[model samples]
Target: MPSRQWPNILITGTPGTGKTTHAAQLVEALQSSPSTSSATWEHVNVGDFVKEKGCHSGFNEEWQSWDVDEDKLLDELELVQQAGAKVIDWHTCDLFPERWIDLVLVLRCDHSQLWARLEKRGYQLNKIQENNEAEIMEVVLNDARESYAAEIVVEMQSEKPEDMEQNIERIVSWVQAWRADYGG
Candidate 1:
């Protein structure tokens, strides 16, 4: 893969596992950090990106969500991935090309907490149950592992606020180390 100024990290997990929360905070943290001040980091929410880039085929009534055209979405991501300073947030991970991502953090929440989060969001019963099952099965975690190098994929705990803080600290250090090893 051609080198870039910074890393492209993907924060993925089943719904209600704080993937968006982690992605947003990571960008904010990276942007403010002195070590990575030379790079501009952004939180790219895939769902919104799909709509913005016209990568969706249509809404799915059964799922009550937009049907993502994976090929179109991947095509739209080519340039953005090359830029290489984004925190991409999404539930699905394996579909992204292996080379586009440098790190994959799969946030996992306790089943109870996951349920509460989904419920608090007023998710439909079926949607909540489906996500709960997916989390229990470790679907996203497995997909991330299969999609990226073992060293690049991390399973993170997302049950408490402190976990998020710790993740940011570790990732910041990782960024600095990456800079040491790779020219920006």
Candidate 2:
């Protein structure tokens, strides 16, 4: 492996915006490259990591979700963050430190498209509506911009299959460029 650190890319967005899909594709693409063979690329799903690692303090009755303690989660992810080359997929972005993340891809979907995707997931009507509203409002994009430098944060549309492919290609190119510039 190169002595230079690899990038820690965060794929964050409103639920059902295809963050996981992008993350998985990114990992697969990177792992297939001979240049990146020495580098370790991990797809860290924050929601599942939190649950499996017991990083949350408690569960939320209203949302029916775990109340993730930012500090605890960070503590638990310390080693992974330090290892780098991580594709961190999560709905929230601001909790992760700016220094640890090299790129933030805030995936966005059209309100109607996002609504249908969430609905297909069997999400409650209220939850679906809430996520749709968040997408319409560009909450995740704004949060990513606020949490990371503008140069490091990108807002990409993922409403269609082509959009997702384009995103994956763009990030793959980015990784190639980064390796060329920084890796041995």
Candidate 3:
């Protein structure tokens, strides 16, 4: 594939909203079913890379450490640009350059469901409440929308995996269409 035909897909959402899960599912689906042409799928997590590198000073004093410096993230994104047609997993979509992002999938979850998911993850009550409220307030989703073009899609994930799968399928088809339309 040509470099100019790269398709960058951004999968973002509030905490516990299934962004990573859906991103993984999308990658699997794409890889399992080969496209008519030479298109390929890659999944990149900005947060995990950041945490692995210990790039953030603010997180050093935390009880559990997960830090990704902004500068380091930019450096990693350079690799994603070259990878082409990849699914990016990160909490903050606006941090990336708009020129490289083609599609933004913002996962939204119900407050009660989100709280339950966080609780299941062993988060403290305060942390659960904070994430729930942040999601309800649309802090992350709004940030993605503000930074990207109007095509930013808002997908909802309920308490069931089936619900999540539906959204994933929708995104998969969207990616297929984009590839067809944009000459990817």
**Most lDDT-accurate candidate:** 1
Q: TM-score winner between 1 and 3, please give it.
A: 1
Residue runs of model 1 more than 4 Å from their true location after superposition: none
Question: Model 2, residue 15: what's the lDDT?
Answer: 97
Prediction-by-prediction clash tally = 0, 0, 0
lDDT of 2 by residue, 93-171 (tens): 9998777888899998888888888878988888898888898888989988888889889889988889988998899
In candidate 3, what are the lDDT values of residues 70-174, reduced to their tens digit?
887688677657656788987678788887777888878889989889889988777788788889899887888789778655645545889878877777777
The list of candidate 2 runs beyond 4 A from truth reads 1-4
Candidate 2, number of clashes:
0
The candidate scoring highest on TM-score is 1
State candidate 2's TM-score. 0.94
Clashing pairs in 1: none
Which is superior by TM-score, 2 or 3? 2
RMSDs, each prediction?
1.1, 2.1, 2.6
Tens digits of per-residue lDDT, candidate 1, 1-184, equal 3388788899999998998988889888889998897788888999899889989889987777899999899888988888888899999999988888888999999998899999999888898999999999999998888778899998999888999999989988898888778844
Look at candidate 1 and tell me the lDDT of residue 80: 84
